[model samples]
Target: MAKPQPTDAQTDAEPENTEAAESEARDPAQALADIEAAFDAERAEMRDRLMRALAELENTRKRAEKDRREAAIYGGSKLARDLLPVFDNLNRALNAADDQTRAAAKGLVEGVELTHRELLAVLGRHGVERVSPKPGDQFDPHLHEAMFEAPVPQYAAGQIIQVMTDGFRLHDQLLRPAQVGVSSTPSG
Candidate 1:
C-alpha cells in the first residue's frame, strides 16, 4: 500500500508543530538542568531582597531607640533654661547680705543661705551644674562667655580677670556660658 503525500496546509503547519518536536529532540537532563538553574537564580534574588529589608528594619529600630533616649534626656530643657534667672537672683540676694546684715539679721541670712543651698542641691540632682570660673583662671570659650576685656597689670592676656555670673550646664550640654571678663594685658 502506497502512503498519500501531505497537503500544502499540512506542510505549513509543520513549523508550528516543531515546538513539541524540539523539546523531545533535546536531552531531558539538559532541559531539567536549565529549569533548575532558573529557579536557583530566582531564589538567590529573593533571598538578597529579604536580607536587605531585614537590615533596613534593624537600622530603623536602632534609630528610633536613640531618638527615644535623647528625648528622655532633653525633654525638660526649656523649663530648666527658664529657671536659671531664679537661681541667679538667689545668689545675688545672698551676696548682698554683708557682715553687718548677717549680724543684725542672722536668722534671715541663714534662711536665705539654706534656701540657696537647697536649690543648688535640687539642681545638682537633676544634672544642672554651675560652671564657676574663678578670677585668674585660664579663660575657656567653651564654658565662659566673655562679657568684657580688661588690661590688668597682674594678669596675662586671655586669663579670666573677673567672673560676672556663673554658667549652668545640663549634663554634657551647656545651658548658659559663664559670663566673665578676660584680661588683655600681656605677661611681662
Candidate 2:
C-alpha cells in the first residue's frame, strides 16, 4: 500500500499543533528551578513576618519590665508624704524639751529622741530623704518654697535665710517643697 499525501488544511493544522506542543514542553531542570524560586520567595516572606513579630514581642517585654520597676519604686509615695506630719511632730517634741525638763525626765527625753531617730532611719531606708537647706545656701525654687523674704547684712540676694520645715523626697521625686525664707539685699 502507498502512503497518502497530506492536504493543504492538514498541513496547516500540523504545524500549529507542533508549535503548541513545543511551547508546552520544558526541560526537567528548568521546571525544578522555577519551583525552587517560588518556594524561596514564600520562605523569605514568612521569615520577614516572623522577624517583625519577634521584634514587637521584645519591645512589649521591655516596656512591661520598665513599668514594673517604676511601680515598685513610687508605689508608696502618697502614703509616705502623708506621714510627714508625724515626723515633724516628733521633731517638735524633742526640740521643745528644755534642759530642766530633760534633766527631770532623762529617760523620757532619751526615749523620744530614740524614736525620732528610728523613724528617720526607716524613712531613709525607703528612699525618703529630708531636704534641710542650711542658712546661706542658694535657694532652689524646685526644691524650696519661699514663705517670706528677709533682708540682712550677712546674706546675699536669693539666699536661703531659714528653712522653716524640712522637705522630703521619694526616689528623686519631691514629695513636698521645703518651706523657706529667702534673703535679699538690705533695703536702702
Candidate 3:
C-alpha cells in the first residue's frame, strides 16, 4: 500500500502531542519524592488526630478524678447538717439548768458536758467547725441570719448584739447560718 500525504492540521498537531508525551515521562527520583510527600502528609494528619484524641482522654480523666475527690470530701455533709438540731438541743438543756439544779445533778451535768465535747472533737477532726460569732462582733449576712433588729447602746448599727443559735461549717462551706439579733440603730 502507498502512504497517504499528511494534511497540514495533522502535521501541526504531531509535534504538540510528542511534547506532551515527553513532559509526562518523569524522573524516577522525582516520582519517588512526590509519593513520599503524599505519604508524609497523610502520616502527619493521622498523627495530629491521634494527639488530639489523647489530649481529650487525659482531660476527661482529670475531670473524673476531681469529681471523685469532691465526692469523698463532702460525702457526709447531709448527715452532719441533720445532726445540728441535736447539738442545739444539748446546748439549750445546759443553758436551761439553774445553778442549784446543776449543783444538785453535778454528775449528770458533767456527763452531758463531756458528751458535747467529744462530739465537737469528732466533728472538728472531720473538718466541721463551730461558727460562734460573739456579741458586739460585726454581723456577716453570709454566716448569720438576723431574726430581729433592736436598738442597743452597747452595739453600733449592723453589729451582732446577740447570737440565738451557733452556726456550723464544713470546711469553707456554711452548713448552717447563725441565728442572731442585729443592732438596728447606731449607739449615741
Candidate 4:
C-alpha cells in the first residue's frame, strides 16, 4: 500500500498552528510590560495631583498668616485716630497759657505733659511714629496733604511752607497724612 498523502487542508493548517503557538508563547511577557506601563502612568498622575494640592495648601496658609498679621497691626487704628484731637487740645492749652500762669499751674501742666509723654511712648512701642515735616523740605504727596499754597520767595516751588497738622505713621504705612501748605513762586 502506498503511504497516505497529506491533504491540502492538513498542509495549510500546519503553518497556521505553529504561528498561533508562537504568538501564545510571547503573551506573558507582553502582558507584563503592558501592566508595568499602566502602573507608571497611574503613579505619574497621582504625583501630579499631590503636588498641586500641596501648592494650594501652602498658598492658603500664607494668605491667612498675612491677614492675621495685618489685623493685629492695625486693629486699634480708629481709636487711635479719635484720640489725636485730645492730644491737640492739650498742646494748644499749654501753648496759650501765660508764663506766670504756667508757673503757678506747674503741677497740672507737668501732669498733662507726663500723660502726653506716656501716650507717645506707648504708641511708639506699638510701631506708631510722628511725621514732622520741616519748612522748606520737599513736599511728599504720600506723606503730606496740601491745604493751601503760599507764595514765598524764600522757598522753592512745591516745598513745604507750613504744616497745619502733624502726621502719624503705623510702621511703614501712613496712618494720617500731614496737613500742609506748599510754596509757589509769585508771577513776574
Residue 28: error of model 3 in Å? 6.1
Clashing pairs in 1: none
**Which digits, one per residue and each the tens of the lDDT, describe model 4 over residues 1-188?**
89998899999998999888887785978878888999999999999999999999999999999999998998778777776777677767767778897799999888888887887887788888888899989999999999999798889999999988888888778888888999988555
Which sections of candidate 3 miss by over 4 Å?
Answer: 2-34
Cα error, residue 130 of model 2, in Å, equals 1.8
What's model 4's lDDT at 159?
A: 97
Q: What tens-digit string does per-residue lDDT give for candidate 1 at 1-188?
A: 89989999998998878866787686778888999999999999999999999999999999999999887887667887898888899889889999999999999989989988888898888888889999999999999999999789888899999989999998899999999999997645
**Per-model CA lDDT versus the true structure:** 0.90, 0.92, 0.90, 0.86
Model 4 gets an lDDT of 0.86
Worst 10 residues of 1 by lDDT: 19-28
Once fitted onto the true fold, the runs of candidate 1 whose alpha carbons sit more than 4 angstroms away are 1-9, 99-109
If scored against the real structure, what TM-score would every candidate get? 0.83, 0.71, 0.76, 0.74
TM-score of 3: 0.76
Error of 1 at 170 (Å): 1.9
Determine which window of 10 residues in candidate 4 has minimal summed lDDT: 86-95
Name the weakest run of 10 consecutive residues (lDDT summed) in model 2.
20-29
User: Candidate 2 lDDT, tens digit per residue, 95-168?
Assistant: 89999999999999999999999988988998999999998999999899999998977999999998889999
